[model samples]
Target: MLSIDYQQLLAPIQQFLQCETPVTWLDVAQQPAQLPILLTDHLICELKAAQSAMYLIRRYAVDEQSGEALLQWLKPYEDFTYRQQGDWRALADIKLKKSMIPKADSGFGQELIDKMVLLIKEELHHFYQVLEVMQQYKVPYDKISSSRYAKGLLRHVSTFEPNALVDKLICGAYIEARSCERFAKLAPLLPADIGAFYLSLLRSEARHYQDYLQLAEQIAGDAISERVAFFGKVEAELINAADTDFKFHSGQPLAFSAAVGA
Candidate 1:
């Protein structure tokens, strides 16, 4: 593995977001007792990230055939994550074909397909990596509810055309950036191999956020600084607010604090 000056890598990411991962959340996240839920949520987060990318491509960029192909490509992993019905060992060989047909004459279609295909590939690979780590840690697979974090950001999306797509892309940027930030914060606090794996993800995660932002700008065809800042505030508020649920992307854990007090 290559050496990283994490401080150097994370500086811009830190500057982009409105706030940091709360120390209180980190305190609970690193506990041994919290590992099960954390790993489970982390695993699902990877899957959801891939699904989000796939959905974006299918809805806005690809033809119907390509869209169906995308869904089929993702099905096995979805089965494993959602139904626990497949072998994790076999996922490494799963690959998205290179010849996806783009929607006819759409300006952003090809670009969206290019960027999102790569994101979907990386995210699915990460889904497998997390599952491998879970197996090593003896964390059994179990379904868990998503945290309010994503919904909180998405609920604000404009219910109009290109605005809706642009908003979704902006929200994707925040989600990736926040994931990268939390991974950096929690990596050193975890056990060695897992810490290294999380650290290994920094570059791609950072790039994923940038990719989403660039796509957002391209789709909107104007300066999105105002909208980006708008989401920065929404994302920060979500991160800062207290929550009973504790997932990988959860806000501060009120439930954990209450347990400790009791």
Candidate 2:
């Protein structure tokens, strides 16, 4: 069990989420055999988070050359995750390399670069941490299809400029909030070392959720409460409804027999 007040850490996230994770999902997550799949998905989630943050910065904040540098910095990890050609050791040097991010004239641009660069750094570090845990446990990394959770939320993104950006940031907030909430939920059920690691991640994840929300509100330049509520409902439905697959963010697990029968 974690020695910290996890509920206190998660209070804000819990308030942000419209619904709690389903009991059925929690039941399945507690099983010992689910660890490999959980950790593998978690490892990928970290990379995806970093990649998303990088894209936001590249598309809105940085110059073309800086964008290329960002891609190069992420290339080794991506190669390993996607192509399975590179070793984990190749990711070590990436942590030390810093890319230049030129300041943009627009306030939103500079703000995005500032916040997202720090987010990218932390997420990449977390990815490495997940990989370390996976290696220790002999959990091989394999590409798995993404959970329906994110795609469901993203389908609501507006196909325009600032609205698109604002909606994406809102989605980012929900994703991070859910991730933090799930970590707190899962930590106690995991073994000592893994539990401690998950607990260690809470502080950063909390900050990330806040960062995304702040950026969304700032970019929107008005009350985003309604839009936030809209996405909250969408996110809650995804969390609460029945789901067939057992991903880190998947809903209630479909019974094996049910799947076989289908």
Candidate 3:
């Protein structure tokens, strides 16, 4: 029972950004044979996204309530990943975090923290959903190497205080935006259930990107246009470049037949 009216949510998000996701993302969705691998990568990426949010919460958001809420929100995924409790009966009552990060010390910290926590919750929920789907489809889980996408984007950080944080936030915006864009592009290609689930994510994912961009702007208190432009080029290159791994966030497909072929 997906609650999203995807077309309504995605139109504004795509319009707000200066970019559109590449079409190839949907192409992957159409190849159901590849879904197992794609979803495995997707599951890991979701947890990684959640971890990024948790790090921000721990580092900047000083509220104990927010921390507890985060822990509670992530309980299902954490239980499954660490404690191996992903049985069907164990996933019924998953709840999102209740606390919001405060905008006191630095709006940047609180704002990003709030958005990221929600994003993480959704991503992990999505992860759980994907795992369920995988189990139904008989896709076995395996630990795989990460793609160069995140690493490539992270390499551009300024190696200093606010600048580094700013850069990271900007990168986050691109990642979330790209994800939203990809969801929009791919949802229709999937089967009814999975398609509905992906479409359901559009609203939150779009808002998450906007939240990241807004935080980047507020954190700088000045024109981040240049920084955005700088990262735009970098992100575009990473998206367009050649890559061997097939990850949720991997670069342009390498045309190599094998899923993990390096």
**Number of the top-ranking candidate, with lDDT as the measure:** 1
Two-way TM-score contest, 1 vs 2, winner: 1
Number of the top-ranking candidate, with TM-score as the measure? 1
Pairs of colliding residues, candidate 1: none
**lDDT scores of the candidates, listed in order:** 0.90, 0.87, 0.71
Q: In model 1, which runs have C-alpha deviations exceeding 4 angstroms?
A: 1-4
What are the TM-scores, per candidate, against the unseen true structure? Answer: 0.96, 0.93, 0.79
In angstroms, the error of model 1 at 133 is 0.5
Clash pairs for candidate 3? none
| 1-262: candidate 3 lDDT, tens digit per residue | 3235766666665654555554554455468777877777777777777877776676666477777777776766666665667664466576653757564776566566667767776777777787787787788776667778778888998888777777888888887777887766667777777777777777777887777778778777788989887888887787766666667776666564334343
Query: Per-residue alpha-carbon lDDT of model 2 for 1-262, expressed as tens digits?
Result: 4444877778889999999987778777877788898999998899999999998988878788888889988888889999997778668777525555655565788778888988988998999999999988888888898899889999999999889999999999999999998998888888889988998999999999999999999999999999999999999999988888888888777673254347
lDDT of 1 at 47: 89
Clashes of 3: 0
Error of 1 at 167 (Å): 0.5
